[model samples]
Target: MNAILIYLLKVIAIQAVFYLIYTLIFHKSGRHSINRFYLIFTLAIGFLIPFMSIPKFQSYEPYLEVDKPIWYELSDLAEFSNTEAELIPVERINQSDFTTELIVAGISLISLLFLMKLIYSHFELIRLKRQSKEISKNGHRIYCSQIESPFSYFKSIFIPKSLLDSTSFDTIMEHELVHVKKLHSIDRVLMEVILSIFWFNPLLYLFRNRLIETHEFQADAEVIALQQDPIAYQEILFQQINAQKVISSANYFKLNTIKTRIKMMNKNQKLSKWHYLFILPLMVFLIFSFSSREGEEFVAPLKNDVSDVFDYVVNLSDSYTPSIFPLKDAEGVKLTASFGKRIHPILQVERMHEGIDLKTYKGNPVLATADGIVVEAGIINEISWGKIIRISHNGIFETVYAHLSDIEVKSGDKVKRGDIIGKAGTTGESTGPHLHYEVKELNKGFLNPVDFINDFDFKRYTSIEKKDIIKLGKPNQKLKVVIDPGHGGRDQGIVSSNLSESEIALMVANQVFENFKSSDEVEITLTRDKDELLSLKDRVSKSEGADLFISLHMELHEDEEEEMMTAIYNYQSEHSAASQYFGELLSKEFEEINRKFKVGYTEGNYVLKNAMSPAVLYNIGYFSNSESERYLNSEKGMKEIAQELSDAIMASKY
Candidate 1:
């Protein structure tokens, strides 16, 4: 609302400035017809612009589902909990305020008009009372009488009985009558009202006065057109000027009126045809500005409240429970038939077929193999799999189903054994529509899902035992370290000469893992055991309570002068001391491999900034140096750098 108000104010200011320019260039210089038109048009624009402006509303929430606490709960506690909090109810305030404001504004406008009318009436009454005191003593005056009406058009200016012989009095009477017929006094009052509304607008006031002067100019022109001796009329204007003092609202026959009126009467110049040219463009611009629709765009209503829909799903899941029962094994289930080698689709190699192939028609319902909660169910546009669903069976064991047609369940939904969760489809890496399933022990690792299903009973499906998946060494005990590879699935981070940073990092991480694995007293866990991308933040977050964090990378230098050197970047505020110690130790270990391996430290790097534990980022080699670049691209060269990285991390004390 504030933004919209500011925009309307700007447009009004621009129009006002243009109006001022018109007044200065044309109206103030000399009398012209176009100037009169400009004056009227400018006043109309000032009155109408505010009414044309509209308000804007552009705020909405996005749809997202995740395991997290509510946002309000996470904000500052004192502010959110206070009873007297000044929270703006946007929806309620917008409707009520706009309607009430419009009503009040309408009433204010009507009251203003009535007040202006009263003020004009009062001033006219005061002028009339003053005029009645003076009487025509000269016999040359035809007639003189002051009537009691503030409106000049209704008031009669009588030619006295004795002043009839004077030709100047007759001419003056005719001129005053013209002013009365035109209602010039009423026009002056209207202009004053306009000036009051646009008090700060100098152009409006200028145009008002100019418009009145033009009215007189037009009336004088009519008098001259009569051909009744212009010099005699000029003299008549002078005699009538002092006969009555100029009323506040009077527009003609006032003090100093003879000087300008006589001068204009003497030099009568008709307006040229070309004088209207300037108005053509001004009219066009006004038509475009006033007639065009330039307000906020309308938005269509949504089918459902998205936030409410999400809440509904969450409530449904909270109330849901999965039913468990025993499963019956098929008769004549040969061991070899159940699990054996099969021809691979892409590799064309005879490898172990780890899972059973569930043959079903297209769109046939596929059920959850066990009582579990849905951990992932969504459409995937990856190169290998299209749509997939993975469920964690009590957080100990899990099953995955790929190449699904449609997923009926979302993450966090609990399911019972044999529940229809999806339909079969040939979504990704398939010869036909079939369900590709896999099961894994929570910590122990992958177990052929088919093996467990054959003897499993839905009612008797007990929780599996948790296994120590990745063994870690005792605290203060010498432990072998493994730096798991990052970005292997389909993402190859930062590549040079077709050699990816992901592949290089993986090679180095694996080599380091192997070097440490040879030590009996040391245990190792690679961040990733296979080619896959692990989120850097997630990995660092879990590395809390870990002995060491070794993030490997191949450096890309834009400057040729920056050569092959191992730089370690760490957060200065959080882990500065630990990072420095780790860097010094790593540098010593790398020195044995090659003297060119130097340690560079940076406190501004993101990975180390929030790390609660000691962390080190190793830039194994530089792309700018041809020799180091070549070595980094090869398996053998990577192994050597990896060996140094492993020895450095293992040598560091927590």
Candidate 2:
């Protein structure tokens, strides 16, 4: 669900850029069909591109962890322990409605209502068509009704009685005929669905307005091109300026103000094809703008800086970058303590302080440090903190806020940095009511929260160098492979006395990842390398660019001696022959590598079945069988399995 919202947002952003390009560059310069094609292409690409990942090849080099880095506390004399001290949940007297779940649920519910309205509109149009008297006029189907207004729905045209006898009927018919033959209703339905799905994006609404205008311009220009009396058509359209509005698909002649239609009709100039080429640069800009964060070698700008900040703070009303104080509408917040060694206030023992504590009101609202996805949220009895929220800015950077009076986000919730994540209070190993803030860069050093805030840089970065861009700008010559490791986090698959599905799958996937990472022949990716539970939506969204996909898993059964492995594929896949061929190759590899194991073919696993690429689900030996379980967990078993799979992939002719 979180992935769906993120994808929608990415698409909305891309669509906004494309819409701007069309309005400022191509809309006025080219002929109707040319501009129409551009608009459609922009819409189509915007909707699809978020699913397509830009290639990123980071050198998977090793790094050593510093025992004591810049941000390391002086109080770490005590060793870390898995068992945390019993902690109390923080108490907040009054809480506000600033919560992530409510906001997401509200948006989703509203979109559903919008969908219902769209369905109603289509059905209402159909009901009207069924009740109306039908007659054939000039090789078109016309439905005569008592409606005060006239409009076309799909291939059927509905006309009111007042217009049937009027002299303007032929001109209106000419307009409606163009709409029907050109299949404008299909465009209307598509636009309606797009709007329904992305109703939150104001840019889409603006784009819709432009699209409606373009449709009218095309139809009006066609009617006038016949050398019919243009004056008569203008008079007919404006005469119904106060036309009764009705629930229908768009592009009505009388519904909107007649000024735009009349103005377009009055124009008399031919545009040059040269203007359309301007789109090339804008497309490049859009790609670079988004690719910065996802590509390797690109240092992320401070999230919500400059234009991103403009979008949230100035325009959309949110905050990020942890630039501001956590307390909202507060003045002169003083730092009570620094992040370092401190005497445990209550315990009377020395300890390293990993986080900075700030002096504030007991129930003051606590904001997020940056724009990120909530990785962890809730009260933890196993930790010193009562309620903690951890958010990951990218995959590499994370911020943790501990000892909160209340938590407003859950795992997988995307949040802006300044949004009130909770109320600050004393909870779990706290001396007093305050907020504990920490910043950690995975595999790097943790930085002082204060220093990180003050020294935050907003430089934009990208990995697509000139030559790389030129290569990517052309058609692909490299193979793209995505590997999905089945089950993770709380959704850990098939657990038994000794073997864990998620663990074994990840171990094998990691080896496969290492095998492919060393080679430049294929661009390899994993749906997950760690135990972060991803929804089916999230998995499918990231699997868009794969030429071949493999999902790893281990399933247990009732029989203890059942040790044979099975490779599953999408029986309904478009490339079924290719999948079958690869499945056979995998069976052959397993048989040749280890005679102790046998391979079989199966069909219809969800992850495999839904993959767009030729994908398979490779289930390792069942943990249900004790002998197989011991063998699967052995280091030798893991290496042999990984080698065989890698070899099979390399040996594939496809």
By summed lDDT, the worst window of 10 consecutive residues in model 2 runs over: 78-87
TM-score of 2: 0.43
Which candidate achieves the best TM-score against the true structure? Answer: 2
Candidate 2 residue-wise lDDT, 568-615, digit = tens: 455346754456456656777887866433222223445665777777
Error of 1 at 367 (Å): 44
- Looking at model 2, the pairs that clash are 75-351, 75-352
C-alpha TM-scores of all predictions: 0.39, 0.43
lDDT of each: 0.52, 0.65
The number of the candidate with the highest lDDT is 2
> Which residue runs of candidate 2 sit more than 4 Å off their true CA positions?
1-13, 47-52, 65-98, 297-654
